[model samples]
Target: MLMDAFVDILRTIIWPLAIVWVSYIFRNELRGLLNRLSLFKYKDLEAKFEKELLEVEKEAKEAEKLLDRSLPHIADNEQEKIEQLLRIAGISPRAAIMEAWREVECALNDVAKQEGIRVKGLVGNSLSADKLAQIRGIPRENTDIYTRLKYLRNQAAHVPDYVIEEREARRYVQLAIHLAGVFRLKPNE
Candidate 1:
């Protein structure tokens, strides 16, 4: 058995060596053939790379449009409301809190829309704030902020007598602004 195995190994080695000898004997022809094959491979690789690059460029353009769409557009009236809320944050903390949450929701909806998340449907939107955070590849800390903002919004909207402090409301607004920035969508002041 050992002799047979040795013979098999020698046979394999001999075939390779014979191929090498043949190649050496026809070195010029082999070289030309190899050069042609390499050139073909290079051309194919280059074409594939160019195709991939075009795809990347197309995706980049689409991404730019998506980012533009994600930007929150504060209408003149909405900006006025924000200014009013900021001015009276102390006097009407609840209203300011509600407004801040609403702004966050608005930003979330805009981002969701840009992400192609349908809002109205039987399935509802998969790109809620949580899913958006994941899709945007946000850090855990920032995702936590998103979760907190959503919680606060839910509380202010659905929960009864959810009195939000001015400080907390301000923080929510800051988080909303941060979320907007995550998608390269700076809210127009």
Candidate 2:
């Protein structure tokens, strides 16, 4: 039984890792060769596009930072105070929070149509490493944040009577801040 189990793991995990390692070793050479191909003669244009793409990414990152700083991780207790923060920050606090969580989910889609890093879940599902990376210029290493927020969002939505308590809200704020930092976003000024 042990030998069979070992063989199964070798087939599923070890083989895949070996393939990826080989591909990574040749990644740079592949890029250079692709540039030399007749169909890819416009490599110079590609380089220029990369630069412009990077600039747009930077601008988006700035917007994210502005929003993160303006919105408190620990939103106040009063509805009026929350509204005031939203107004001052030029955002809808509830909407922004919900949307941010959704965005993280969509990042795993295969249809992003951009070349950048991506995070994969345990099932090998893809997430957009680009939107977050372009905005924050950081990579996602751990896969915990996605699962945790997803659980919370589901719980809140599924149970009509379940209200997010103050304690839960505070944790969300802290989680967002920690995630922002993971993506290399500095705490707002």
Candidate 3:
């Protein structure tokens, strides 16, 4: 009877003990798997971001075609700024995306000022694509693309855990450049 009791105890303890031992032994592997899973999730997020940006670009291009005119060319200095932003993307994708969006913001503020619209706060601090679009009578389609770009920029800037890929960052910079060029055009032009 004692032997049978001992065997029953062993059976109950063995599985729990083995589980604890295996967990301890494979802790590092388990941690690595968790990290990889996190990275995989972020990869999926990055892919979705890229797809959304692509759709915005396509919409912008279609709008341009429908308007039967291309966005006016920005000045050489503006082109230089865009090139600098592209180079920055190679080093820090997040910074590049942020700076590229800043260019668009700056352009919007400048246009507002040129239109005699009173900018309420510090130069670029208070301006937004939406506000500028509403006040300046910008086309609805153009405003939509600008808003979408701003949304994507916020995703890159606000998501602490997200790592922006360099290629995607460059694409964002290109889109910002296009929007900035559009904003920089004089009303008469």
Which ranges of candidate 3 are over 4 A from the true structure?
1-40, 122-131, 134-137
The better candidate by TM-score, 1 or 2, is 1
**Candidate whose TM-score is highest:** 3
TM-scores, all models, native as reference: 0.43, 0.30, 0.71
Model 1 Cα shift for residue 105 (angstroms): 1.5
Instruction: Single out the weakest 10-residue window by summed lDDT for candidate 1.
Output: 121-130
User: Which residue pairs in model 1 clash with each other?
Assistant: none
What is candidate 1's lDDT per residue for 39-135, written digit by digit as tens?
Answer: 5554454354344334433443444444423445656875676667676566765566566655556666776776787775222122365576566
> 2 or 3: which has the higher lDDT?
3
Best by lDDT: 3
Question: Per-residue lDDT of 1-189 in model 2, one digit per residue for the tens?
Answer: 999999998889987899899889999988776655633434443344334334434544454454434433443443443444334324333333454454344434322323344435411222443444444434333233444455554544543333333333433433433443344333233
Lowest summed-lDDT stretch of 10 residues in model 2? Answer: 121-130
| lDDT-superior candidate, 1 or 3 | 3
lDDT of 3 at 134: 52
Candidate 2, number of clashes: 4
